[model samples]
Target: MSLADSVSVTVKHKSHAADVKPPTKTTARPALTRLERAERFWGWIMVLPLLIGLAVFYFIPFVQNIFYSFTDLDQFMNWSTFDINNYLDLFSDDDFYSAVFNTLFYVVVCVPIGLAISLLLAIGLNQNIRGKALFRTLLFLPAVTMPAAVAMVWQWLFNKDFGLINYLLHFFGVSAVGWLSDPDIVRISVSIIIIWSSLALKIIILLAGLQSIPRSIYEAADIDGISTLRRFFCLTLPMMVPTLFFVSVMSFIEVLQIFDVVFLTFDRSMVESDTMTVTYLFYKNAFYLQQKGYASAITVVLFIFTMLITLVQMAIGKRLKVA
Candidate 1:
């Protein structure tokens, strides 16, 4: 063959080889066995009821609440128009501002104090101490007790004239203090109850976290001659970050919605402007005043604020994990 002919023949052979490539095998996924299919079916069946309950109780009402917030809906659910007046009034209302302040105060005062006390209690209880079980049971009793009963007991304890607290204070030459009635002192009084009641569960959770820490790690720390405080800060705390983050987020959310203790502890007359939290404000509007629309608006703001706070915490937690 001539040179050009030979080149053309080679190119033709290469193109033919490329076009006639071997067939590739494609792997097909094996069909699930009958038992595997049955397992998945039962798993979904087990969760279906919970999913239905959540949709009915949480999701549907949540969407409806958002819609109602813009309307002037009454307790009877009657409304002629939808407007932004509820939100507008919410921003301008002094009571709303007061509620916000009170709620924030509870969050600020309760979360850190509760966490710290809970951590200390957990640490102490985690040690091999005498009567530790009894102590833990005593501490955890409040968590299982009814809120109404707890409130009733705390109310008596907080009584100005004859309460245990004031009686003790009187011994120190301090005059009687109106814990529930005085606006200046009521927040602190309520915070005391909140922190006390919340400590049991927090202690239990922190104790679990403490127990979960590996013994070998601590033994290594001891071998290194690390001081207790240094071990905590350098080893224990970093390991407990995830548990701490969980507890903190839960505590923040719970404190932000403080209502039952305030309501049951104080009479209606004593639930004044200074002591009213956002949840209590919502309750008063929704039930007492029959202004469901305005109540919904209040809840919407609270929901947004909660979402923002939780997001911020999660972001901070992500950074901590990365670090």
Candidate 2:
């Protein structure tokens, strides 16, 4: 009786557990929090429009431009040839070499001058000076002024007949010098314009960099009896290497791509044929001569040069900092 009763109770207990059912063997997944899910959704939503616009406007055109460079793309659309002939022609073109030289010269001249002027201004303004704001405003005016207007004013000022500069030269009993006509002087004149236009932004950036430097460094240098020039070289400049590098690269890049001011200054002048830049050549070939493929090739070359220049500048910056 005891064995049968025990067995029956054990079977009843097992039957009850089976009927109650064990949990299913489903894998557990980590569910994102409500805030996380919302953030992910909004992040995509925010970036989607920009990505789309970039693909449509920039990426697509860039690819097309490169493709066109390999082909004989003309206004008539008659030539279907695709080869490296355009690049070969570019290498052989005398005008291309001239443009390259002019462009490099512009970069070499304007970048250092612009940086020096901006650095000087920024350093002067960083000190306590009366009417500092006024000086900044005056210096920055050229940057805000329309390039066309600046060219007009400068042309008149440099006019050999009655321009202000010539008038001043006359006051000194010197004959009026041709400012815009001479091929030799044209690049110098253009460089001046480029420096004037780019000076203000550089000053502002360098000034910010100066301000970001800790006052403790200067105080420590003063206690060490470092002279003004020594402190500037040892303390200020080393700290500003990053900013200087940034400004130098940007300035050279802008000078290399110069077109607006050149067009304004010389496009209508008799010496228009003298001051040619690579960008100007690009415009001329693509729009005027309708040599689209050659123009595209020039643009590709320019892009590569820009990248190489940026890398070289970065390397030089690191080396300078180490030294």
In terms of lDDT, which candidate is strongest? 1
What does candidate 1's lDDT look like per residue over 88-118, in tens digits?
9999999999889988999999999999999
lDDT for predicted candidate 1 compared with the true structure: 0.93
Please identify model 2 stretches exceeding 4 Å from their true place. Answer: 1-31, 76-79, 268-272, 321-323
What digit string (tens of lDDT, one per residue) describes model 2 on residues 29-124?
889999999999999999999999999999998998888889988987556898999999999998888888888988989999889989999999
What TM-score do all the candidates reach, one by one?
0.93, 0.86
Poorest 10 consecutive residues of model 1 by lDDT?
A: 266-275
Report how far residue 310 has shifted in candidate 1, in Å.
0.4
Off by over 4 Å in 1: 1-9, 12-27
Q: Estimate every model's Cα lDDT from 0 to 1.
A: 0.93, 0.88
